[model samples]
Target: MSNYRHHSGYCGIEVRDMHPRIHNFTYVSSCVKYMIFMLNFIFWLFGGLLLGIGMYAFMDKWHSTGWVRLETFYDVILNISLVMVIAGVVVFVVSFAGCLGALRENTCLLKFYSMCLLLFFLLEMAIAIMGFVFPQNMNSFLEDKFTDKIIHSYRDDPDLQNLIDFAQQEFKCCGLSNAGYQDWSKNEYFNCSSPSVEKCGVPYSCCINATDISSGLVNIMCGYGVQEHSVAAAGKRIWTNGCIETVRLWAERHLYTIAGVALSIALIQLFVIYLAKTLEGQIELQKSRWAA
Candidate 1:
């Protein structure tokens, strides 16, 4: 009789432990689902942010250069940004819906959201691939726009010769003296140096002594010239080239990184969908068993 009583006590203890164990699992499962939903939502937010930045860049400066062919190409790229914005919005909405569905263990909504996510992910991959592949052409477009600016600036500046003389003195070259001219050569030293190398042997450097007040004054007072404008133009060209080159390099270097992040987000969403589906099946099974 005592043995029977002890066995009953043990069985009671076992049943009590089982309830808490099952309850703990239920709590953990709920937490996991919430975490998965939150992750999907965060990735959706990231996509939206990128889309916004791209659109801002497309619309801000690039939109103003419509007179240049490069600007025209930049405008064309605006379409790509627009598409990204649309895609991001769609993904955000669908992912938000998916999160809600996951939280509620709704199978149909989960499936729909998964399909949308997959479609958009593929679309983004295609766009990224295109950007990576045609980076050189894009860089050329940026370069052309910058070169156009230089050419325009050169044409517009009336005091360009003075500017060139001033810049030459700043560089500490011999001015017209270095060009082997007793007086500044009318044709060769008109703009500090000859444009045609064949006509003038070596161009004169523009260094003038302070004691030689006339040459110094001439440099200071002269209008903008080819040398000054060309220097400025070259600087602008280098900056534009560097900007385009950096962008191209980034696209090339990070093509796989971008794709991987995108794909990882999609995979995570898929996993969440799967987990939600499994939970839905379990809930149904529990209902049937309870009814039985």
Candidate 2:
């Protein structure tokens, strides 16, 4: 029998004999295919980790609270747990499709993966554009509603409370409103009218030395009744600026770093989409040869 060499273009395998049985030969580039799979796999693992953490947090809160009413759903989403769950689900679904699609060389799955990535990229672009076009509106949303919701719900959830505390300590700022530490008054536990000892007080996290281990012990009650003092007096003990202002300044300082990171993420996504599409085309071409 005479040997007939068959070569398919672009990462196609060489065949010694022109037999239809060679249909199983891989036409896609191994590098591209594996790269896609690995990328999705990493994200898949991350999604699963987020899902697990979210579930644990949610369940722990539920166990501690003993009951969850339908009326509390608004507060639920505002908390980090529910947010994590939603984010995890989205990431998991999209990465799952990508992982399986690349491994199986399934066109439909690859199409779905690429479409999802495109949608995400477009949504991010739109959000970035809107932020630039209407900076005041975006800032208003964050300064007014978003910050208030989180501040109001501060005492309602431990995770959220910790998060706000961490932000306060890290940014060296107190509260989310312009009133600075006085914003804690919005919290039911710290409200001036509240009977709790913590009334009119900000969390320990708002203290200047909250995280300072130099003394070998932290003064958790350092912020107690701090609001009763004037801002001038409190300024000596705690941060006087609101977290909103502090964070805004921080963002401005690191604007270039943030932009670079965002741009890199966008480009990486586009590159992955390109690889998926290229592999899909290569597979289609190989299938056509098989049919011929």
Candidate 3:
């Protein structure tokens, strides 16, 4: 008599627990449990992929995560990678716990998963706030790091060399010293002050336009002696100014987009945490009903 009864859902304005107080009745729907399980499964699948990629990138950049030697100027170079790896590790672990909980319907794993999600959500929101509030800190650090020292030490690391070349080409700027590829002087081969064979030469990245983008058709000589000419004469031949000004300007222009992306990530994590909490609550309620 208590388990079976007739009742209308009150104009389709359903009440989940109104009858629980009136009749001590409870409902545990397998559909809701399965839905939450599947959601966690999907979330973990994508999270695993992101985690793997982030770890790979971090390892590749530092060779070993042990002691990443960044001189004083390069100290902040690890900031981005460190945050990403930390976030990636947390997401992976939470997702693993979620997978175990969903598959086994274990209360302990679900509780851990929910708690981890909340903790990570709060941490990310804090970081996003700091990132937006003081974006200049990052910009200044990068401007300092991307100086003539890179050109002088470019050959020391293949990764650093590639990054420097990419930055010059993308920003359409040149040199550590002044404009018109004079910055090339910092490199031994292009030391115009010493009058070497490669003196006054610029890398192909400094040209107004590349001969080939796909194949990187470099006129090693295209940059040759271009810095010897006056700025007016070199206007058509090579880029002027160091990357600092242009890159800073670019960051200023795109600052809003960067902040928006950070906010969006925070919102997504908040939603995920909400979902985990709701599922945990529902599971607890279902357990109570089963015991009754």
Candidate 4:
């Protein structure tokens, strides 16, 4: 019988030779762990890349248009990007820890790494909820704000009034003065021309009627010789264009990617834990056989 040593309080502990098959199993498990660690590392790298791109797009590269003012929206998007950057960094760090723990067979480090993965998973869920709940409404709110700004600016400017009059006289439209042109595009009473001069075959009037001017209303009237239909059409176009389908697509893709990374990390950690438990069990069994 092999010589026995006391391990802590336990006695008759023999260091038995591991079976060749058990050694092979350990080697295979090690290889699998390494592969999983590499895969997690790749995911971390990609997440960082995505986060950087989002930050640049939201904070550095985007510019607001005349009808798509983003002063408030910019701040919101900036905050979201900042959160994403932080999450990416956390994922990278935790995944690295998990790799190290697996290589070193450190159970403590593995538990901490699992916690990080859970943190990121929760964050992704929160982001997904926000995206689904507010993207469309947020877009519409921004559009309305932009339109209000344009109308308010025009209403406040005397020079704009003169310009509108000139446009109306040139195009023969009653301009902003008539109630018929108040919601001219939607109202059948006004003879508003097509948005395009080529299509309308007529010049548009760019004046506001006195009766149509309210104390607080914004003037949406275009320049003289510009059709009311054209101006209204242009406004609608700007509003629609600002909130494209691309924004929703971007949000959805990011949410999915983040969730996938978190899940992958979790699976890897579980696998490593299983391997450790198996190795421990095998070591115990070998000691039993040697004692027998």
Best candidate (score: lDDT): 2
Candidate 1 residues 1-292, lDDT tens each?
2222222345466322222223223322566567658876786787778678757744643455432123454334224444566666766777777677667766677677756766766786676555667666655655555433422232222233344334344444322221222122234333345564323211222322233366544232222232334334423311112223544555567778876887787777567656656655665665565566
- Better-scoring candidate (TM-score), 1 or 3: 3
- What lDDT is obtained when candidate 1 is compared to the true structure? 0.48
The count of backbone overlaps in candidate 2 is 0
Global lDDT of model 2: 0.84
What tens digits encode model 2's per-residue C-alpha lDDT throughout 43-115?
A: 9999999999998888898899885433655665776887898899999999999999989888899999999
Model 3, span 88-172: residue lDDT tens? 6666677778777756667788789878877777887776665556656754654466555667666554455676678788889
- Structural RMSD, model 1: 14.4
- In model 1, where is the ten-residue run with the lowest total lDDT? 174-183
Model 4: ten consecutive residues of lowest lDDT? 235-244
Cα deviation of 204, candidate 3, in Å = 2.6
- Report the candidate with higher lDDT, 1 versus 3: 3
Instruction: Give candidate 1 misplaced runs (Cα > 4 Å).
Output: 1-32, 40-88, 128-233, 236-238, 242-245, 253-270, 273-292
Candidates, ranked, lDDT: 2, 3, 1, 4
Q: What is the lDDT of residue 114 in candidate 1?
A: 59
